[model samples]
Target: MKKFDKERLLLAVAGPVIALVAAMVLTSVVLVASGKSPVEPYSLMFQQATYSDVQVLIINEAGMYYLAALAVAVGFRMNLFNIGVDGQYRLAAMVTAVVGAHMSLPAGLQIPLLIVVAMLTGAFWAGIAGVLKTTRGVSEVVSTIMLNAIATSVIAYLTLDDKFGVPVGNNNTTGVMHESGWFPGIDMGDSGEIYGFVVVAALAGVLYWLILNRTRFGFDLRATGASQSAAAASGVNAKRMMLTAMLVSGAVAGLAGMPILLGDVHTYSLSFPTGLGFTGIGIALLGRNSPVGIALASLLWAFLVKASQALDYEGYDKEIAVIMQGLIVIAVVVSYEGVRRWGLRRQQQRVGEELAAAARAAGDENNGNNDSVKEVAAR
Candidate 1:
């Protein structure tokens, strides 16, 4: 490959490596301070990964994480922070579950209907923040934050026994979906079943890459992210792009929790998964907003989670994984900035050298012309 391309790739790889090494080193120190062996936890985690069931669990979880990260990355692309992903996801899942529970349609039709319902629900929820941002000039961060709280209250109200929720021992839930509404998964016998939505997530990643890298709307979105003034000067509708981005982001987020509900849990209960959206921000940042990078990040995160389960039995705090994850994201942010500055410096130096060479060549050419002119005059 070209030298410049190689350098870019090297820098790209270097950021993640630097972050990982820094995080590991700090985690080791923390483990030592706690009078625990860091190596032991890692070793046990690796051994646990050898089990097929654990591997299956990791894949299923990774798929869910991939979708959440994608949703967050969409906003990241537009320089918008949709912190309300958790709310959008939960509210969508809850409503989808309720709607699906009430239906008795066939799998082919029912599955798509539930999914569409989920996406629309999330879009409408997130669209509120988008509309407020475009019309009221409210910051997306502030608006999304408020929306998350409002979503929480709305969910709480919906889950009341007097509403659509059913009592389940200690927790209230949207009643389970019928068999026809369930998304069929890949059964791994005794090992476990892989969520079918994982395949859908993979497709989503492909679409994300294609749309962002290969379309006019993506160009407008990214250009606006880089500089709204430049994009607006170019005739791109910045407000429209912002609203569209939010709608797209929340729609993907709506799918984030569907795997767990449709493929495994079959209901939206108080025990249903939460915080996946928050975790996605870290993954999206770590991955640098690349679809493939995000997939790898999600897998790595899922691995850490699966490994943390055994840390408690090893006399280590399972929260170590959480600590490590936090450290990784922080380190990545710092390292990426450092690499970016270094790259910028290198590029400037390269440009300076090229300009100097061009100047020297021009000077030589001018001297030769002058010498020829003098010789011709003498002749």
Candidate 2:
């Protein structure tokens, strides 16, 4: 049994590594077909990776991305699909920006209030889909997708109108938010763009881990995810769990938008909240839904994005960077699924063996009892 467990563990660890190598090989083939030297680009990427500022940038960016991915993972844990994170995040940021722009509150009150409001806005947005799924029996996937379109349209309409719009001269953007609402950066001299939000993200991760691993609510969620019928039989409320998961997912996603809205831009704008939600799906998969793993994966992704931006200076194709992102996600998913299937098969085999052994023991006991009866009857 020890050996079998060890073998399974090894396979679980090795599978992703093998898949990454395979992905690299496949990418190399594409590079060759394009008449580009894969070796040069890869070497350049490594060279850029070694800089200290670049390292810090990766860390900062990764922390934000990981937070967003964690939101998606929370839904995944409950077997609830929440593709509406994109919409939730956008609406939250927009609300926060608008509030910050108009409010005259002090820095201490304003910042926390914005963060709280953002979280509530996101949760409320996601709750709409949750309500539809529970009350109307609507599929969350369909509802969330439609919600995204609705959210986008709403933002567009609000931003275009003179009464509420940001003065972007007919463009969809909000006015600059007040300085009091901005999140301050942790200033390490000569370090670029590092914010206090990294610490917030770490705290968020710790809180998430606690919520998922130490709470009864989390147990119910996992139970429902494993099997809805079994969860129901065990007195778990699967529908409530789904609703809770989506709400939590949206709150986390809203928090994730803070770095961009409060740190970098200090305002909401059209296309400003772009792609992070979708990118989070890839980050979550790469992280394997584990907090530490997700943090590491986010950093790797950040590095790739930063490196890709550097390509413009070297006259290299920026599209290659996007390709790498897609490839990594594909590789991670394929690897995780393969390893999961292998583990399940092993578990099933173990269960079968245990059942067979129990049957044999029962049969032997019955035979022994029969023999004793026969001897007594003969006497």
Candidate 3:
């Protein structure tokens, strides 16, 4: 095949293969140091995860992770690190839940409305960071991190008191949303219910792929990420691209909490989940920010989490999974860098060889002409 195609194929195969190998080696070392055999723990984890109920749980968790990762992936593509996704989703979910709780619209309308509310709120929160970066020369990473702290305080204030909070027995929460706003869960035979919102998460992935691979906006975003100066020279508005990418990322992050909110909890409680946004960052890096890659990475992460739950029963530490995950992330980063270096070396070698061949061909042609001229002179 062509050199570029071959290089692409090699990178695709090499990165994950090398990363997995390195992770396994490191994890094995850890296990040995802990006085445990790596084989038995892994086998037990996998076997337990194979159970029907656990499989559903894995998918359910993956659905949420899928959305979060996609959100992070969007910002990553634009060279924007939107660390505020944690806050964006929490605030979005809180506002959407409160609004949804009060609305009595039909299911068809209410569900979409709540989703739109999520997107809008998430975009608005993220937009703050985008605006700061574009207009004030603020670093997005710093702005977003600060925004997350603010969002947490805001969510706490709104959800903790009677002003927006509803009393449910002894708990304070955004009152339960009506059935109309709930996404029905899908029942798997002998397994627990899977979140129906998984379909939405899947659709989000499709949209992400389409936008990144098929749209001018995506092209601009990627171009900007590759090199802001080059993109600016090409007349692409780098600031605008960054802002738009950040907004879109936040909008997508709004969906991150929906699986739990609509499928299971049906309310925004004090215990509403957090940290998935941070997890998304790791997953995005692991997946290399590709939509398909992120999906697989999400599943793998979910499996590790779900399977590890049984470790406690087996007298093994559940934190082992966390350790393994950390190792995998580190290894994957090293592997990608190595692959990049190897590719650069190969490309240089190829260019050098081509140049040498061309020089030899030119020398041969020039020598032949000189010999022909000499023969004519001698004759």
Best by TM-score: 1
Best by lDDT: 1
TM-score of each: 0.98, 0.89, 0.95
What lDDT would each prediction earn against the true structure?
A: 0.93, 0.83, 0.91
Q: What would the per-residue lDDT of candidate 3 be over residues 155-175, giving only the tens digit for each residue?
A: 878876667888777778998
Please tell me which model should have the higher TM-score, number 1 or number 3. Answer: 1
TM-score of decoy 2 = 0.89
Which pairs of residues have clashing backbones in candidate 2?
Answer: none
Worst 10 residues of 1 by lDDT: 307-316
Off by over 4 Å in 3: 1-3, 371-379
CA displacement after TM-score superposition, residue 235 of candidate 1 (Å) = 1.1
Can you tell me which runs of candidate 1 are displaced by over 4 Å? none
Clashes of 3: 0
Model 2, position 181, has a per-residue lDDT of 89
In candidate 2, what are the lDDT values of residues 320-358, reduced to their tens digit? Answer: 777878888788878888888887898899899999999
lDDT of 3: 0.91
